[model samples]
Target chain A: MDYFLELLIGGLTRGSIYALIALGYTMVYGIIELINFAHGEIYMIGAFTALIVAGVLAMSGMSGLSVLILASVVAVIYSAAYGFTVEKVAYKPLRHASRLSPLISAIGMSIFLQNYVLVAQTSDFLPFPNLLPDLPFLANYVGFIGSTEFIIIGTTAVIMVLLTLLIKFTRMGKAMRATAQDRNMAMLVGVNVNRVISNTFIIGSALAAIGGVLIASHVGRINFYIGFLAGIKAFTAAVLGGIGSIPGAVLGALVLGCTESFATGYVSSDYEDVFAFVLLIVILIIKPSGLLGHKPTQKV
Target chain B: MSTLNYTKYMEGMKQAVVVSLWFMFLTFPIMVIRVNTIENIIEWRWMNMLYIGAGSFILSFVWRKMSGRGISARKESIGAQGGRKFYLQRLVSEKRLSLPALGIVAVIALFFPFVSSIYQTNIMTTALMYVVLGLGLNIVVGQAGLLNLGYVAFYAAGAYTYALLYHHFGVGFWLALPLGALAATVLGVLLALPVLRLQGDYLAIVTLGFGEITRLVLENWNEFSYGPSGISGIPRPGLFGMEMDMHEATVYLYFLMILLCIITIFVVNRLQDSRIGRALLALREDEIACQAMGINKTMVKLTAFALGSTWAGLVGVIFAAKTTFVNPASFTFLESAMILSIVVLGGTGSIIGIIIGALLLILLPEYLRAFGDYRMLLFGIIMVIMMIFRPQGIVTGVRKTYEFHTEEK
Candidate 1:
C-alpha cells in the first residue's frame, strides 16, 4: 500500500510536468495542425535559461525564493520569444507548402536548436539548484510525496485552471478557438489569424517554460538533450488524450505517467521508454482519432 | 525614383537593425552566458552578442532578398511555362551532354581507388553507401510521400542479422547478404501493415517510435544483442575463396559499393517510369484520387516500404562488413536524419540529385574537419531554408509529360 501510494504520487508529479508541456503541443496543433518538433527544444531552452539565471543570482547571493521567481520569469519570457521566433522563421515561410514541408522544417529546426545549445553551452548535465522550500504543514505526507512534488502538482493545477479560463473567456482565447476550428472562416470573421497563431505559440511556450523550471528543480539536474525525450513523451500524451483537446491533453498525460510508473515499477525499467512507444502504437492502431479527438471527415 | 530607392534602402536598413537587435536579445541567455553551477562562477562572453548581432544583420538582408526572389520563382515554376530548367536537369535530359558526363564520371570512379590513398577510397565507399541509402529512402518519401522516420531500424536489422548469423552459425557475407535483406524486408512489411491507414504526420511519429523501440530493445536485450558492447570481428566479403589484406579489402569494398550504387541508380531510374513508380507518384500527389483511379493503395505502400528496406538492409550488411562490427549506437535516429537529409537536400525523387547530395554531404564533412561540430547545425539550417525557399531541392525532379497530336492539326 505504501509502495502503491508512492508510485501514484510519483506518477502525478511526472504527469503534471508532461501536462504542462503537452498543453503547448495541443494548442499549437489546434491552430496550425503542424507538430512543432522544436517545441521540445523550447522547453529545454527554458530550463537552461532558468538554470543560468538562478546560478548567476545565487553567485550574487540573492534569496532563494526571489531567485526562483526571477529565474522562472526570465525563462518564460525567453521561451516565449523563442517560440514566436521559431514559428516566424521556420513555419511562417512554409505556411502554404505541402504538409510535409513544414514538418520537415520543424524537424530541422529541432535539430538546429539542439546543436545550437550544445555548441553554446556544455553538453554535460548541470546540477539544478533546489529552489522549492519545504512547507511546515506538509510534514505528514513526507513518505508519499515531497515538497517538490506537492508544489509541481499544485502549480500545474493552478496553471491549468488559469489556462482553461483564458481559453474559455478571453477575447484572444476565442480568436484562437475560432482559428483552430476553421482558419479561413476565422479570417473571414476578422479574427487576425496570424496574431492568434503567434499568441498560441507564446502561451504554449510559456507553459512549457514553467514545466521546465519546475521539473528541473525537482529532478535536480539539467542538460541540453533533456527536452527530446520529454517532448516525445509529452507529444505521446497529447496524442493519447486526443491532440488539440486541452482537457484531453491533461487527462492523457496523467494516464501515460501512471502507466509508465507502474510499468517501470513492476515489469522492468530497461524498457521504460519502449512502453510509451508501444502504448502510442497500440493507441494509434486502435483509435486513430485518439480518445477524445473527433474523426476528421475527408473532404473531396 | 531615386528618392523612392533611397527610402527603400533606408527602410531595409531599419528592419535589419531591428531584426539584429531581436536576435541579440534572443541569443543573450544561451550564447552570451555560461554559468558553472558547481563552481559557482559566471562567465559572460559579450563578444558572442556582437557576432550574433552582425551575423543576423547581414543574414536578414540576404533572407529578405532571397525570399522575394524565391516566391516569384516558385510562382513562375508553377505556371504553364515550366520556368527555367536547372542546368543539372538539362544535363540529364540531353543525351549529347549526359553521355560524355556519364563517361567521365565512370572513368573517374574506376580510377579513383588507384589514384587516391586507401583512406580516400574508404571515405568514397561510405559516401557511395549513402548514395544507395538516399535513393532507397527517395522511393518511400519522395516518390510515395510516406515519411518513414524509422528507416534506420531496418538498416540495424540487416546489420544485426549478418553479425548474429556469423556469431552463431559461421555464416559468411555472401549468404548473410541476401538473408539480412530478407530480414529487413519482413520487418518493413510488418511495420507497413499496421501503419498503412495512418495519416502522414502520424506515420512519421509511429515510425520514429518504432525506430526508438528497436534501438532500446537492442540496447537492453543483453542475451540477444550483446547489450550495446556490440558484436565484433565480422568478416569482410571474400572473392572466390581468396584471402586478402586490409588494403585489398578496402579496394574491393570500394568497387563493390560502386557496383551496387550503379545497380541502385539503374533500378531507381527504371522504377520512376515503371507502372508501380507511376502509381507511387500518383499516391504521393493524392491517395484518394489514385485509389479512385484503380490503384491499390495498400499494395503500393507495402511495395514502397519493402523495396526501400531492401536497399537499407543491403547497405547495413555492407556497413557491418566494412566496419567489422555491429552496434545499436551506429543505427541511431541521427543516421536516419542524415539519410533523410540526403534524400531531401538532393531533391526528392531525383536520382542524380540524391547521388550528388550523398557525395557532398558525406564527403564534405570528412574533408572539412574544422567544421565537424557545425555539420548537424548546418544540416538543420539547410533543411529549414530549403523547405522555405526551395522545397523542390537543389535539383528538381521533372515530371514525365507526353504530347498529343490530332489528325486535323
Candidate 2:
C-alpha cells in the first residue's frame, strides 16, 4: 500500500510537469490551428538555458538562493524570447498560407533546432545541480511521505494556482482569451492579436521552461535530445485533455503522468511509452475532441 | 524569389551569363577529370557539377519552368480550374515510352556484365531496395494521403521476421519475404484500427511513437531479439539450389531484384486503376466527402496501411538477404523520415516522379561520401524550399491511373 501510494504520488508529480508543457502546445494549437511541432524544442531550449545559467553561476561561486533565482529568471526570459522568435520566423509567414505549409515548416524548424543543439552540445548529457531550498519539512512530512512526489505535486499546484490567477484576472490574460475566441473580432475590439499570440507563446514557453528546470534538476541529467519524448508526452497530455483548454490540459497531464508512472512501476519500463500513446489512441478513438475538449460543430 | 525581376534587360543578361557560366562550370570539371575514367565519375568537383549544378539546380529549374509552361498551356487546354489536372496529363503523355526499344537495349546490355564493377553493382542493388520501399510508401502517402513517419518499423518487422524464422527453421528467402510482409500487414491493420481517425500531425505523432515503441521493444526484448547485439550471419538467397558465392558478379541477385521491381510496378499500377485505388484517392482528397460518397473510410485506410507496410516488409526481407544480418539499428525514425522525404520530394501521387525522387535522393547520399554529415542539413533546407515554391511536388503534373480511377463525389 505504501509503494502504491508512493507510485501514485510520483505519477502526479510527473503529470504536473507534463501539464505545464501541454498548456503551451494546447494554447498555440488553439489560436493558430497549427500544431507547433517545435513547441517541444522550445521546452528544450528552456532546460538548456537553465543548465547554462546554473552551470555559469556555480562556476562563478554563486551557489545558494541567489544562484537559483538567477537561473530561473534566465530560463524563463530565454525560453519566452525563443518562443516569440519561433512564432515570428517559422509560423507567422505561413499564417495566411495553406494549413499544411506551417505544419511542414514547424516540423522543419523542429528538426533544425534539434540538430543545431545536437551539433552545439555534442550530444552529451550534463548533470543539473539542485537549487531547491532543502527545507527540513521535506524530511518531516513531504519527503517522509514521499519526497519527489510531494515536491512535484506541491510545485505543480502552486504553479497551476498562480497560472489560474494570472489568466483569469490579468489584462494580458483577457487579451489572450479574446484573441483565441476570434482574432478578427478581438482585433476590432482593439486587442493586438499579434501581441496576444506572441504573449501566449511567451507565457506557454515560460511554464514549459519551469517544467524543464524542475525535470532536469530532479532527473540530474540533461541532453540536447531530452525534450523530444517529454515534449511529445506533454502534447499527448494536451490532446488527451482536449487541446486549448488549460485546466483540461493540466488534468490530462496528471492522468497521463500517473499512468506512465504506474506502468513503469508495474509493467515493464520498456513498455511505458506504449501506455501514453495507446491511451492517446484510445481517447482519440473514444472521443476525438479529447476528455475535456468540446466537439467543434461545422456549419457547412 | 521575386528578385528575378531585376529589370527585364538585366534578367535577359543574367540568363545569358548564367547559361555561359553553366557551360563553363560543366566543362571545367569534365576537362580536369578527362585524363582518368574513375576521376571523371568519382572526383568531388565533377560529382558536384553533376549533383548541384546539373542535378538539383538544373532539375529544379526545368521542373519550375515546365510547371510554369504547364500552368499556361493548361489555361489554353482547358479552364483555369483544370490547369493542374491538364498539365499532369500532358506531362504523362509526353513521358510515354517506346518500351520495345528500351527492352532491346536492356537485352543487349545483359551481355556486357563483365565490364561493370562490383562497387557499382552494390550501389545499384541498394538503390533498387530503396526504390521498392519508396514505391510501397507511395501507396500510403501519395494514394491514401496518410503520412507515415515510422515506416522503418514495418521494415524492421519484416527483416526480423525473416531473421527469426530463417535462422530457426531454415526458411528460404522467397518464403520469408511474404511471411514477413504478412506479419507487418497484421501490425498495420492493428495500428490502423486505433489511429485511423487521426488527421495529419496527430497521426504523425502516433506513428512516430509507434515506430519508437517497436525500436524500444527490439532494443530491450533480449530473449527474443538478442537485444541490441542483433542477429547475424543470415544466409544470402541462392538461385534454384545453386550457390552464387563461387559465381563471378552478383548478377543473379540483381536480376531477381529487378524482377521484384517489375512485379511491384505492375501491382501498384494495376491497383492504381482499380476501384480500391479510387476509394483511397477519395480518402486522400477529403474524408467527409469519401464517407458521403459511400466509401468505408476505415476499411480503405486500413487496407492502405496494410499494403504500404507490406511493401516495407518486402523490402526489409530483401535488406536482410543483402546484409545477411538483422537488427534494430537499421530501422529508426530517421529512416522513416527519409522515406517520407522521397515521397514528398517526388510528387505525392505520381509513380514516375516517386521513382526518380527515390533514385536521385537515395543514390546521391550513397555516392557522395564527403557531404555525408551535411546531407541531412541540406535535405531540411531543400524541404523548406520545396514546400515554399512547389508545394505540389516536383514532377507533380505527371499522369496517373488515378485519373480514370476517380470515385464519384
- Per-residue accuracy of model 2 over A35-103 as CA lDDT, tens digit each: 787888888878777776676566556788898788888888877877886786567655665555566
Maximum-DockQ candidate? 1
The ten-residue window of minimal lDDT in model 1 chain B covers: B77-86
Query: Which pairs clash in the backbone of model 1?
Result: none
Q: Tell me, by lDDT, which candidate is best.
A: 1
> Lowest lDDT 10-mer window, candidate 1 chain A?
A136-145
Q: What DockQ results do all the predictions give, each relative to the true complex?
A: 0.75, 0.13
| Cα lDDT tens digits for candidate 1, B124-166 | 9999999999999999999999999899999999999999999
In terms of docking quality, how is candidate 2 classified? Answer: incorrect
What is the CAPRI rating of model 1's predicted complex? medium
Each candidate's clash count: 0, 1
The residue-by-residue lDDT of candidate 2 on B1-409, one tens digit each, is 3565656546555554565455444233222221121222222245434444444345445544655664565456456544445354455545354355446646744643456676666667777777788889989877888877778889998999999998789898889989999988998888888887787656776787788788878988899998888999887887678756623426666666777877888898888878998899888888888899999888899999999999888888888888888888888766887777677766677776676678777777666556755565555555655555555566663445334566899
